[model samples]
Target: MKTARAAWRRLEPVHGMIYFVPEARRRYADLGLRGRAGYFASRSAAFGRASAELVISTFYNFNPDFVRQAVDGAWDAASPHQVLDARYAAVGEALRRAGIHELPNLNEVLALTRRAAEAACEHPQGRPLFAAHAALPWPDDPVLQLWHAQTLLREFRGDGHVACLLSEGVGGLEALVLHAATGEVPVGLLKSSRAWPEEEWADTEERLRERGLLDGDSLSSDGVLLRQHIEDRTDLLTLPAYGVLGDADCERLAELASPFGRAVVEAGLLKLG
Candidate 1:
């Protein structure tokens, strides 16, 4: 059982629960739970035409009894505690406009979204909010770009393309060194750099070595991996905050960077400089 569970965990995407929000809302409402009704409504509204079917499905799933109570205002005299369910439903409806759809089983999604919303609310300065929005591309906030970059690095771990890219930029070198310290680089490569000139390459190498790019000898075990990570991240850096990349701009930037840009393309990274 434990092995099966572990396998399942590995197979599941990081935020799988959120993906089924629309279905979860319907299931709960059908069972007479009003706690998330309003929430689902609000989410539906936010998603607009993209998720209209999901929103309507949630509405029809609402408990008939709860619907009646709401229409008749029978719970108006109830204490706050007694009326909490209604409050949640109302709030959910408001949030529906913000793209929070009903999921198939929302316990996890609710917990996740609630925490995110709370954090966003606390900041209210728009930066955190924007970050939250941007986080939609990943499973969760913590995973963001770095996690994606690492995943790409792992996919192309031994490719020479990654190594060549790391050899190019000071920033890339620094990032590789950092990965080395974390054991994300390969150890053998760290041992090979010894033949290179100490005086000419000393400063940059020392800086990267300090950051853990180099071990006692060649590139650290993580050097190649980190190089790949940096290359992947560099491609992302040129992308818009919303994650869109313009082909024309990419072409122009690539042209400007010339061989460097072509190298990025060959590495299968973004075409933009």
Candidate 2:
């Protein structure tokens, strides 16, 4: 489990930088996907004309109305195949700019991450988003392939995370409120980014209070314990994919990928939500 987490913690930036970069927005706009529409569209492109409800279910933490608005007419504006092409192009541009191609052990990191990603493909029973992505043909370029690999790992962990959240009876907004209590992200950012209205956000918090998961703005002792359990379970769930790497290779994956992740951050490619 530690290995699973360490591997994800390092590779996440490699996959996550797509959301914050200007390149994504510009490319999505070129495809007529405006605002957050690009995010929902490009990420869910593998679904090929996925409905908003499907996006909401897979994405999990976002507001249903906001997700609907994003996915509405998205496929009409751009086909899933086109969105898929555009997103790869955008990532390529970003990675080239960030000097990812110039990094040492680039091939080595790619090899490891790809191996882990393939392992994820084996057990897709309830992991919808990951299963959708895992079906896509691999990109030709090694760098793009590396990005795709990390993307798989991220989605694999994410799908498991959503399941864990559901098992804990944590809805999207309630999960966000609990996340805010831990201070991993600011309350304002989490609420606004997910498009939860202030009233709805407060209402969610009030409900958490009633359930004794929250004490005012902070997580109560019980809430903290539950949150820890959720995280532990999420990490454990990822082991089936990462366990194939064994502990040493998992740690090595992190060490080799650290510089690449740092390059993205140093290049200022990453943005806070």
Candidate 3:
């Protein structure tokens, strides 16, 4: 239902900003990370002691070679768990330093978010990818539970999006290209972050142009439709989790969460972009 999508839109700004917040990234660097490369390498490594390729291919949905290149020597510098711990600690520190108060009714938000997220595990049909994380014991701390719930919902939607993208023949840079076309992500940052060769990036753009999904520097009408289709499907896939609360509750959750997210944004700790 539209309410599910509406609720997700409201919650997204809060749960998703951690990845883009400058302070969080700075925290990783402070912990001895080597820049953007080390940040991705370490953060994505949180799932466990896995190869960079596997993490990229699974969690990041990026080219394995690119991730491998970025993580070439990161692990030797710091273990995965150490990096993961630092990332979490940094987020908390960043929030504190920003003076961004916790969400009002923190306990209520935590209870609601956790319950809805955990419900997804009960009937994870078509969402088997969430099984590992879903099975993890819930944290006792309300803030930690909130974080865990956010992570689970994110992965649940992400894995489904990846499956849909693959079916549409969009992988790695191509998927990034389409995402940039949507006007949400800046092309330059995506290009640099994915570590794609200039020529390869240009070639992909040309290919997309030929497919009528792109114009000189923007998505064509068809491109917009294609992107919308992908997004609509992604939203639909997330219904299994959001549905646990029903439409009214979903809106209530979103309403309760928006202020907390706004506080972080207002504090300049997180950027909507």
- Model 2, 60-116: lDDT tens digits are 989999998888889889999999999999999998999999999999999988998
Residues 1-273 of candidate 3: C-alpha lDDT, one tens digit per residue: 677766666555556666777756676676566666655655465455556766676755455677777677777766767776666666666555544344567677666677778877776565544665676666565655676787777778877888778777777777788778877878887877677788988899899999998987688998888888888898888888888889888878887877666766776765533
lDDT of 1 by residue, 1-273 (tens): 222122212312222222123433443444343443334432332222213343332333233343333333222323323233333343233224322243232233233323323333333232321332334333343222222222222212212233334455434334333444555545334323212233433565676767666775456756656655655654443222112213543233223323322322343332111
Assess the local accuracy of residue 160 in candidate 1 as a C-alpha lDDT between 0 and 100. Answer: 23
- Work out the TM-score per prediction: 0.22, 0.98, 0.86
For all predictions, the C-alpha RMSD in Å is 23.2, 1.1, 2.8
Work out candidate 3's RMSD over C-alphas: 2.8
Range of the 10 consecutive residues with the lowest summed lDDT in candidate 3: 94-103
Candidate 1 deviates by what RMSD?
23.2
By TM-score rank, best first, the candidates go 2, 3, 1
| Best-matching candidate per lDDT | 2
Clashing pairs in model 3, backbone N/Cα/C closer than 3 A: none
